[model samples]
Target: MEGMAITRTDMLSVADTVAREKSIDREHVLEAMEQAIQKAGRSKYGHEHDIRATIDRRTGEISLARYIEVVDEIENEVTQMTLGEALSEKPDAKVGDFIVDELPPIEFGRIAAQTAKQVIVQKVREAERERQYEEFKDRVGEIVNGVVKRVEFGNVTLDLGRAEAVLRRDEIIPREHFKRGDRVRAYIYDVRREQRGPQIFLSRTHPQFMAKLFAQEVPEIYDGVIEIKKVARDPGSRAKIGVISQDSSIDPVGACVGMRGSRVQAVVTELQGEKIDIIPWSPEDATFTVNALAPAEVSKIVMDEESGKMEVVVPDDQLSLAIGRRGQNVRLASILTGWDIDIMTEEEESQKRQAEFNERSERFMEALDVDDVIARLLVTEGFTSVEEVGYVPVDELASIEGFDESVAEELRARARTFLETEAERLDTRRKELGVEDALAGLAGLTPAMLVALGEAEVKSIDDFADLAADELTDKEDGILKSFPIGEQEASDLIMDARVAAGWFSQEELDAMRAEAAAAAEAEAAEAAAEAAAAEGAEEA
Candidate 1:
């Protein structure tokens, strides 16, 4: 073993070659070798090896020495040596100084090579994992340009610059298709470590994607000249967007639409023919609402601010168009405008107008008082009406503002006088309209089928009878399904039929059924007689 041809120079050069090839530091390789050799030495020797390892950092030279302490006499087998024996190798030896003892030449065998290779491979794997972890951990929420690698079950695999990302099935817009090797941009939503590798999640259906698309296409949006106020999408079918402009000079709608519909068409083509509605945003909810119901003219908008509701009236010709097929237009407009919208045709509006006219007419007939709200406020202010505050005590009326005692007394007298005359007039009108007789027709109605309704005090045919199917559904659960009728049919049954008991006279219904049977019998008998005549003629 001592006569082996291996030299330290050869090992040093070989260490440098291994370190460079594996992209590891030369000193690290040397340290690994020293550890391996120390382990081997301890295995070969029964006791721990008195080994010292040294390396030249630049040259990658590693040298190992077995050492013993020089002593007057050898006391331990591993550490101590007789001074005369130590001085034989070294002429000047001290009692405590280390003495170098070269080990027998033991060339690194196949076992050592295998051990070094295992360590190198393990270190490289850990390094690679660390490198990949550092690389992707900082890439969240970014837009990555990638190529579509493949599509499986509607999910897409994209080849990002340094890794791969998955676009989930639902993240893809409906009816959109991508071919392999197509270039695309995606929003990097998440980056997570997984068993296979780093998993990156990308999305195209996200609302932010639309905002980014607008930012890219419309310079006004990017420059803050126009702002996208709200967006509601039925992904791939249609999208409604509300836009506003900070500068009065810019029309937000036209800016989004571009000249001759270029900008919107670009976005639409990218969405594969998805329709988009670009409506100008208004701070005034009423004005915004009117714009939201675009492509159809609206007659009026009555807003109920407390409920965030707006009842819109459109011409009869435009009602269907405004409501769209299945009410999609108004529904989208509601979503876009953040209001619950109710649409009515011009005819329905006219009926409502007439109803309101009748109510006003009745109020006019009974107008012996101020408005209800004003009356309530007056009572709170220690006055009941204009006449009471106007005529009786001017000081008391003046306390409330704009009314003196004389004015209060005059108002009180006027109210009293108006009450008497108005009551008479109302009575006359009620008789003329026959409203009392009409209500009386609903009296003493007891039908078993309508027992639940009767228990709820549905005395008038016009009471429960004027209710919509949905209202009836709330009062009596599952009635809509049981009835299985359209809104018009239900309306007709409630309004036209009045009550089941009074729907038709039983005797009249029986007579009609009997007449129908008789007519059917007469027609059958005529047919039989004609057949017999034909048979007789043929036999003759």
Candidate 2:
């Protein structure tokens, strides 16, 4: 190897070849060669000598030198020297100047040549990693085709031609399999620069994987005539996708299903026979929810907008189909429409309504000192609360069948007296629990709410101010859980309590509210677009 003359031209040509082969810059390879040469020079001389090497960019001529730093005081005898000693070597030498000494060029020996090869390989690999990172970073969210390179445990590594990717075990479709050399298509969900290299994570179970598949199969989706609004999947089993069309004449579902189900069949085949339900998307939540639960007809729907939940009523026979095997069908619908859904049969819903009616009837009977007949009549007329009974127009109450002005006046008198007694009892209970008058008097807080808070030991304005909305509105563990208060109303009451507790001036609170309102407005706009676009219980 020493006798084999490596010409400067050959050295430069080899650098270019390696750079092209590794898809790295030639200059980077040359810098790596210079470092290897420098290391070899240090090895040839004393290890303590400070050696550095440089290569002529045009000529590829290698130069080696020993550098001694000029310092105020010498530290190491070989690498550093005093200013006086450096000045003897060069008249204008400064404290920080390096005094260089040229050395005879190194001829590559076996060990040195092997060391140089290792250095070049490592640097080229790093450059390749950086290049792959830069190239693939923007390609996330795209479907990529790859060949299985290896399988370790359940995870599969894919050779993506220019780079490699991993299909994590959890990200694979349930029961799917891949072996060495198997072709695969997956969504590039994440790409990260890891210590080993740039890691590209692919997923066959991602909801978007199905969307991308549709884009590949459906020309309308690819052309933007139809758009996919949302996707929900039980991978390797079933899926639902919400699609809408800008062109009203072009049916979104038919376009996705294609002629005789050919298009969807292709996607199903690729997904290992996972079933698909192409839901026609709508801006209305109730409409979209109905469409998402296809093959199961809905009789009626009741939505609670504040809680982002809906109750779907279906025929008794359709319950099994609506909820699916292991509740997968309703679960996917909930995920697609972005609403927590409760599915109940017609008979079940009727029983619920009758139970509520009986409860209200009992409440009226106890509050108004009326018999079951009068209370049942009042409940049937849509009177739900004692407050409504106490404050409704006497003429309206009189207009009910079998009730005249005299009966209406007597009923109103009893209702008002009962409310007065209940309010006094709640106020007494609140005071017994040490609830502050300031907290009791806050807007949006009724006497009943105060009693609930006081019972929960939130006794002071500070306690009220420190409370979160969920502390009052969460279903299972809330102070006023039984109250009709929503999270936003609870949040406002807490802020009011904070202002009363001198946590901040009203002006500061107003400013904070204004900022919050602006943010809420922006977020609501995004939510509206997405609602017009739809997460419920658990996102698949």
Candidate 3:
């Protein structure tokens, strides 16, 4: 014993037997029995149990005896046995179970009463500890229904039928609360036998709890027609469950979801309204990734299986819906599927190919003196440039709005002769201007910017040169911000601009031309309005 020695032979034997049956060390039993005996002895016997008891190591024998009074009539009954009855019990004329049938000289009032009380208390405590140890030792991982007794420091104490258990805060799900005496069902996480008592740890937040709930509710899951392939949970918030079917006719998702989502809803309700996504499990990665990004349509799924990654393309309108708020949908899907997912839009693909063809057509249009709308239309028809419009796809060109098939075919035939005839007429003009070859390599800018500049009459390098710095700047609001080029590029670009006057300094010429034209137009409009007003006055 830790605090006292067990000298009582009967007690020592009983402690050894208890230790053997309980699979505990004999020393542990001895220690527990010593405490019980001490408590009983101190309260009842005023000091301690005086009877010395010891174990017989070889024989394993336990001998016990106590003294009582041999009297004619029993007055203080606990300390005495009547002589006539004592002789009948032994049949050898003995009046005591100890040695002599004679009363002891000790007093028998409060001291005896106290000794009796202590003995009863100590025995009850030992029995309770043993009962608790037997009750809880085999309960680990099994579910138990209990009522909440009280809460302390965020740990809930549950009153199980035979023992109490503790559900710790970390093992509890968020936003879940239990009132006093509320029935709670939890898994027995662990059992600990301590000096004071048996301690049981309960859990309500384990992943297996979800699986257990499904097993209880869903018949297909229990019967193995549907198996839970994997489960990933952000408990009390959301959970993603992957399931597969053994029977091909059975839909695993439908089985787990139940009719009208009742089975999943029951599980969700138990989890305090946490949402669940039941995705069909697949051995194929692409198929699994598509299912993982549920509630959104995927136009195409491209996989890079080496990196275990996949890209999903949605229609332009569904891009935001697929990725979700702050990318939470994709993020959760990545965790659930174990794959990185990326989304692309349809508009991005169309714009990329269109921009490539426009870059090749700039020079062809400049040589032919053709407008951009005609040049781009020809490019789409697969004429390499405006100069090669003879073999254009007339059917394709006619498909573009407002152009008939006959008109498209006629444009193609006229393109070649027009270029040849214009070549003869503008030969000297082209030589002086050195415009024989087309300007190539004009990518890194959109066709929209080029067309807008043309609408503003800044068509060629000579036309751009005719504009002054302020004249070009006044063409558009925040023109520099609108243009993608930097300061040095813009500065070099304006040097090539020119006007029909052949002035090398086109900047000043274009600015003066713009100011004079605006003034003349304003005066003519005012004079017309005044003439109309005078005619009205004469008529009146």
Weakest lDDT window of 10 consecutive positions for candidate 2: 531-540
lDDT of 1 by residue, 116-171 (tens): 45665555444444455567678765567899999998899998755678999898
Give TM per candidate: 0.47, 0.78, 0.43
For model 3, residues 210-297, the per-residue Cα lDDT tens digits are: 7778877899887767888777666788777788988899988888889899998999988888788889989887787778778778
Clashes of each: 16, 0, 16
For lDDT, candidate 1 versus 2, the one ahead is 2
Write one digit per residue (lDDT tens) for candidate 2, span 486-522: 8989898888888999999999999999999999999
lDDT of 3: 0.65
RMSD of 1: 27.6
Winner on TM-score between 2 and 3 is 2
lDDT of 2 at 432: 89
